[model samples]
Target: MPVNDTFGDVRITTHRDNDDLLSAGLGLRGLAGTATRFVQPASPTPEELRRRAIQSSWKGIADLGPRGGFGSVYGSIPHVPGREFTSFAYLPGARASHRVLLQVPDEFDHERRCLVVTASSGSRGIYGSIAVAGGWGLPRGCAVAYTDKAGGAGYFDPADRTGVQLDGTRVRAGSAPLEFEPQGLAADAGIAVKHAHSGDNPEADWGRHVLQAARFGLAMLDRAFPHEAPFTAQNTTIIATGLSNGGGAVLRAAGDDKDGMLAAVVAMEPNIHVRGGRSFYDYATEAALWLPAALSARQFDDVPFARVGAASPPAWMLRGAALRAHGRLTSLMPGAQAEEALAMLRAGGWTDEVLATAASSTSLDLWRAVAVAYASAYLKRDAAHMPGGFSYRLQHAAGVAGPIDAIVRAAWWADGSGVPPGTGISLDGGTDLSLDPTLPGVLTLRDLQTGHGADADQLRAAVDATAAELPREGLPILIVHGAQDGLIPVAFSSQPYVKWLRDAGRTPVFWKVPYAQHFDAFLAFADFGDRHAPLLPFGYAALDRAWAHVAQGRALPEDAAVRETRPRGAGPLTAATLSLPPN
Candidate 1:
C-alpha cells in the first residue's frame, strides 16, 4: 500500500464555469450579498451545501463588506476551474477521522509545482481557512489543501444516531464512517460535537493532521495528472498558511516537519502557547468566569456591544456582584466590584486591548460556550455528562428545549461552528445551582483549573500537548497579528513565540497591526468597522512577502515592527486605511 493510503475513499468532483473552486460559483458579487439560502432547507443537495459552506466560511473569516476592500483592492472572484478531492485521513487504529480536501486548479503550473496547505481556523468546517489560503493560492496557480484538524462542524446527534458524511449529507451513525461518534453517549443526550466529544484531544494531533493533508494533497496530485507521475515535497514547493487555530496548526506542522515536507510558513493571529505563554483553555475559562463581570466596569461602557447609551447589561452587573459575594472578587461596593474584577484579569496576564475587545465576545456569550466545550475535551469527559450540569441540547428558542431543527441538521456540515450555541444547539449550564444564575458552571471550570488532583493533571497534560515549539532550523516564517485581538492576545501568543524563536537563533518576521482585531466578520457592525481595521488584508500582504522570500530568496524584514493602521471612521476604506508596511 502507498504511504498516502491512509487517505481513504477518495472522491473527486470537477468544478467549472458555474461552480469554480474559489467561491463555489457564488462569484465576488454573490459573496458580497447576504447569506446563501437553500431552496429546500431540510434537504439541500450536496452542491447546495458546498456553495453555502464556501460562502459562510469565507464571510466568517474575511471582511467582505462594502468598505472592507475584499473585491475592490485586494481580492477577486477568479474562475479557477478545478477538481476537488475529498477523503478521511486517520491515525493508526483511531476511529475519529479528519477531513482533508485538495483542490487542483486547471491552471496549476506543473513545472514550478507549488502547494499551499492549511488547517481550519477554529472549530469551523473544512473551508474555514479558504479566505486566508485559497484567496492567495488559487490565483497563483497553486494546489491548495485544507484539513479540519479533526475539529469541524461534524455534529453527531445521539438521539437520532445521525451524523454528517464527507459529501455534506446526513447518514445514520453506523451506515458509514462519520467524522466522529461519542464512545459512550447517554440515551437522553442531545448532540455530540466532534471536537469536544471525540475523546481524541484533537488539538494534540493538529500538526500530524496538517502533515497528513500535505501527503494526501501530493498523492491526489499524482492521481489527477498521472502523466506527471510522482509528486513529492522534494520536487514541489509547499507553503503552509492559516489563521487563528489554523495558524497554530501550520506552525506546529513546520516544527514537526523533519522530513523537509514544508518550505515556508505564514501564520496570522495564531492561538499558540510557548513555554511561558498562557494557555487558551486557561484564559478562555478565566474569561468565562469573570469577563461578564468585567464588562460592567465603567471604562468599558463605551465599548461596542458592552452597553447601549447609559444602560449596561443588568445581568452582567449582577454576575459581577455575585462574584464579590462569593469571595472570588474583592470590593463589596457594587460600583467598585467591576473595576476590581478588571484589575484581577490584568494581573493574570490579560492585556488592556484584549479586555476591550472582549466586550463583543461577552455580548455573544461565546466565552461560556468555549469553556464548556474545552472543559469536556481537557477533562476527557463526555460532553453528554460534563461536570456541573453543563450539556448541549437542541433548543427552539432561549430556554425552550425541542427536537433538532431540520434546517440546522441539514446544514450541520456547512454552517455549524463545531461548538454548541450555534446551528440550533444551545449550552445548558445545569440550571445555575447558585444564587448567581451563571456562576456555578463557570466556577466548576475555574476549580478544575486551580485543582491539583487527577482531573487537573489530565487537563494540564492535554494542554501541554498543544504547545508550539520552534520550527525546524532556517525555515522562512512570517507572523501577522492584530494588536487588539482579545481571543488570543499577542502578548501571550505571538509576542512570546517570536521572542522564543529569536532566542533560539531564528529570525521570524512579525507584524503587529494597530487598531485591528480578530474576527473580521464582526466588521459588519458599523461601530466595529469604524473603530477597527480588518486583519485579512495584512495577512495577504504578509503572504506575498513570505512567498517572495521563500521562492526568490528575497530578504525579509529582520526587525519586528508595529504597523500603522487608520480605522475607517464612517467612510469607505482607502489604501491609506491599511497603511501596509513596505516589504
Candidate 2:
C-alpha cells in the first residue's frame, strides 16, 4: 500500500518480548509505581523516552492510585508486543503538522480487524489517549490509532533554538521537522507552544486530523501485513473514541464522516460546544474572572486546596480583595463580596455540585492557565505577539523564569501539557511585584472575551469554527460524561449536545454518572479521592457497550439515564463501589 500523500516519512519501531506497545514495557506494577525515572536523565535513549512518556501519559489520564479501582477492578496492563508507526501529517504549505501514531498489537485479529481512532485529550502528547482508548482496543485484539490534533507537548524554545522532533527527541532549529515553529520570535522572548503559538487554530481542524490518522492507520496495517494486503473500511470495523478535547474531536469527525468512515463514536466528558451552547472559552474566561473570589466564601473552606485557617489571609481572600479594589466586586467586606461572587456564578448557570470541585482548579490556577493559552490560540497570536506580555517560560524561581534548563527542555516531549504550568514551564503573567500575581494576565484574557474589536471578532470566529454538530443520522453514538465535572461541566457540554441530537430526531446512548468529576487523575490525592469516584471505569464500560453494539449487534439504551456511582470514602475502591449498568 502506498503512503498517504498528506503524511511525511513514516517511522517504524518494533517492540517484542519484554517490551510491549500499551505500557512501553512497563507492566501493571511499573505503571502503579510512584514515579517514572529515566536510567540517564541527562541523555535518555529513545526507548527510555518512550517508556517515560507512556508512564507520564498514563498517570496524567487515569486514576492509578489505590483508591481509584484501577488495578483491582477495571484496568489491566497487557503484554502485547507489536509494531508502532509514526508520522507527521500536513497539508501543503502549512507551517504546523499533526502527529499520527498507530499501534498494532501482535495479537491483532486478522480475521476480525478492528481499528480504534483516538485524539489526545486536552493538550497532552500523542499518547494522551492511551489510558482511555488503548486500554480496551489493544486487549481486544484491535489496533489503536492516535493523533495529537495539532496540539501536544511539542514546545519550541526560540532562545535555545531547540524544538521537539517527531521521535520524541530534541533537535536544533532546522535539523528536523519540528511540530511547530512560529514565524516571528526573539532570542530571549519565551517558548512557543503548539496549542498556543501554532497560529493555525488547530482546534478547527481536529476532525480532519482524526480522519487522516484513521486513513494512516489503515495504510500502516496493510504495510505491516502484506499477506492481508488491503485493509479497507469494508473489512475493518472502525470506532472513534476519546476523552475531553479528544472526545470532542471524535464527535466532530463523526459529524464530518459523510463517507461513512466511522462505525460508531464513544466520547467521554467531551469538550464540545453545540449550537446555542456556551463555548468553553467564553465560560472558562468567565470562571477565571470569578472563581478566585467566589471560592473565598466560608462555605468552600473544607474543599480540597481551599485556603482556610492559613497564617494570613488566604490566596483567595487576597485575590478577592484585589478584585474588590478593582471594582469587580460590589461588597466591601471580604465574606460579603465572596457571597456576591458566588451568586454571580450561580446566576450564570453553574450548579453547586459542579462548583464543589472547583477548589482544585482554583488552587492550582488551572482556569487562568487554560484561559491564557486558549486566548492566544483563539486570536491566532504567537509567543512574541501575545497580549499583556503573556508567554511561556521555565520558572527557575517563584513567579519568575530564567534560562531554559537542558534536562527540562529535553523532557518536554514526554512531560509537557501542551498548555503551560506543566513540565516546569509556566505562563508569564507579567505581574507587578506588589500586586496579586495573576491579576493582570487574567484581566487581559477576560478583556479579550468581553471587549469589542477585530481581535474579539477574530477570537469569536476561531471559537465558532469549533462548534460541533450532531453526527450523521442513525450512527451508533454513545456519550458518557461525569455529571459533576468541574472543568467541562456536563450542563455546559454533554447535556446540551444530547438535547440537540434528540431535537434532530436522533437517539444516541447517553449515561451521566453521578459523583464523577473530570480529571480522574486527581483521584490520587487523599481529600479528592475520598469524595469522588474515578471516571475511567464508566468510560471503560461505555467502550464495552459501544463495542457490543458495533461488533455483536447488541441494542443500546434509547433513553438517557443517570448511573449511580459510589465514591470511595475513607477506603479503597472495590467492585461494589461502582454500580455500573449492565452492558
Candidate 3:
C-alpha cells in the first residue's frame, strides 16, 4: 500500500513494509498528482506552501538511495531526539580538521528523511552546505547547495534564487592518497626508453611520477570514502572536475572509468598534448638552471646522465655545451648554466627526440653535433663556435652566455615560439581550478614532445579523436579568447579550436575581450576578488550570457555595445568609482 505525504506545494508518495520504509518518489508526475488533490484543496498561504515545497524537496534527497536508509537516519528539521551523530577527522599533510553534523526534521515522522550538513576548517579547506528554502514563487520543492569559503565563497545551487554560506574546516585524517606509477621502466632510464621502461621508482621520469601521484591520491579518496551501498546508491551521478593540473587528472580519471562511475568531467585548460613527445633529458637540458636540486642530483648521479645524453642529444647540443662551459667558467654554477640552456631550447624548431638524445649522448659527440647544428641553423655559415660575421656579443646573447640571461631564457624556451612570452591569452573562469587543470596537460605534452613517450601527432589527434567520441547531439560551445593573447596565440590556439567545432557542425559562440591578458580575464571574469570594479560589470554580463547559453538552454542576444572598443588610454570605470564623492 502507498501512503501520500504533502509538504507545501509539493507532494510525495511513500510505502512502508513492517519496520522499513520502502521508497519515496519526487518526480513531476508524483508532485502534480498530490498538489492537485492536497495542496490546492488546502488553498494554503504562500509562505506555508513554500515551506512545504522545501521540506518535500529534502524528502526526495533523503530518500534518494536504497531502502531509503540515507533519508531515514538524517531526515527532518530540529532533528529526532537521540538521532544526531557527529564525526571528526584530520586530513593528512594538510593538517586540517573536519566535522560533520546531521539533523532530521521534526515534522516528518519517518526516520529516513533528514538534512545533513558537513563543515571543515583549515588555512584553506573545502566545505559545502545544503539547505531547503520554501515559499513565494518558489517551486513546489527546492534544494540549495553552498560553500562557505569553499572555492572562495561562491554559491552553487541548481536553483539560482537560493543563497548558501559555506565555511572551511580541516580533515582530521591525513592527506588523501592518489598517485600514478609507471610499470616496466628501469630505475634510472628516461621516459623515452620507457616505451620499454615502465615501473615505480622515485627516479622515474616526470610523466610517470605525476601519473603515479594522481593515482595514489584517488586511491586515498576511495579508502576514506569507501563506496558503501548507501553512498553508491545516493551518488548516482558523479562529476569530476578541476582547474589546471587537477582538471587534467579529473579528466584522466573520467576517461579511465568508462563504467558510468563518473557521470561527467570538466577540464579547464586541459594540457593534454597535440604533438611530439618530450623527454626528461630534453626538459632538463632546456631549463638546466631552474632544474630543482633533487632533479639535478638524480640526473647527474643516479640517471647516468652521460649515457642518456649520448642516446638522445638535443639539436642545440653546441649551445648546450657553450652554456654548460659558460656556467662552469663564469661563477654562474652548473645549475644556473643548465637553466640558460633550457631557455635557448624554446625558440622553436627544437623537437623532443633531439632533447632525449642530447641528455643521453656522449659529451664529446654531443658538443660536436651541437656545434654543427648551431652553425647551420643560426650562423647560416659553417664556422664551428666562431661563425664569421656573428659578433661574440650576439652569440652570447643568443647562445650560451649573454644579456638574455638565464631566467628570461628559461621562460622563453619553456613557453616555446608557438606560445611566446607576453602572448596575451586568458583561460575562462567558468571551469573549476581547484583540481589543477593545466599541469597534467602541460606535463603530458612535454612528455610526448621530449621523451618520445607518446608521439606528438598522435596526442594532437587524441583531441579530435576524443571529441568525435562525444555523443552526436549538438553541444552549445562557448569560445572565450582575448584579441591580444600573448601566452597562447589567439590565432593559433583559440581560432583552431573554434574552427574544429564549426567543422563538426556544433554551435560555437566566440567572445573576444580587448586588452585582457590570460591572468587578468581569468581573475576578472571569474570574480576572484572584489566584485565592485570595472571588471564586475563586464564580467557578469559575459557570465550571464554564458550561463544562459549553457545551463538555461537559451540563445544569447548580440550586444552592440560590446562591439565598440574603448578609446586608447581611456581608463575603465567601476561601480565603486561611480559612487565616489566629488573631488
Please, what is the whole-model Cα lDDT of each candidate in the order they appear? 0.82, 0.83, 0.25
Better model by lDDT, 2 or 3?
A: 2
Better of 2 and 3 by TM-score: 2
- Mind giving the per-residue lDDT tens digits that candidate 3 earns over 201-233? 111121221222222222222333355223331
Kindly list the per-residue Cα lDDT of model 2 for residues 1-583, writing each as its tens digit: 2244488889999999878999888887788685577666755677878888888889988888766778788878788899999998884444688899999998998878999999999988899999988888998899999999988888988877888777888888788887776666888778898888887788888887888888899999999898996888788999999999998999999887777889989999999888667988888878877887888787786887655333322256677778877888878888888899899899989988888876667767788888888888888788888776787877664454443377778788888888887787866755655447677677778877778888888888888889986678889888999877999998999889989988999887888888888989888888888888877888788888888888889898554454557787888887777878775
lDDT of 1 at 129: 90
Give the lDDT of residue 143 in candidate 1. 97
Poorest lDDT segment (10 consecutive residues) of candidate 1: 306-315
- After superposing candidate 3 on the true structure, give the runs of residues whose Cα lies further than 4 Å from its correct spot: 1-448, 451-472, 487-492, 521-539, 547-554, 557-563, 567-583
If both were scored by TM-score, which would come out higher, candidate 1 or candidate 3?
Answer: 1
- Name the lDDT value of residue 250 in candidate 3: 33
- CA deviation > 4 Å runs, candidate 1: 1-5, 308-314, 397-404, 433-435, 560-562
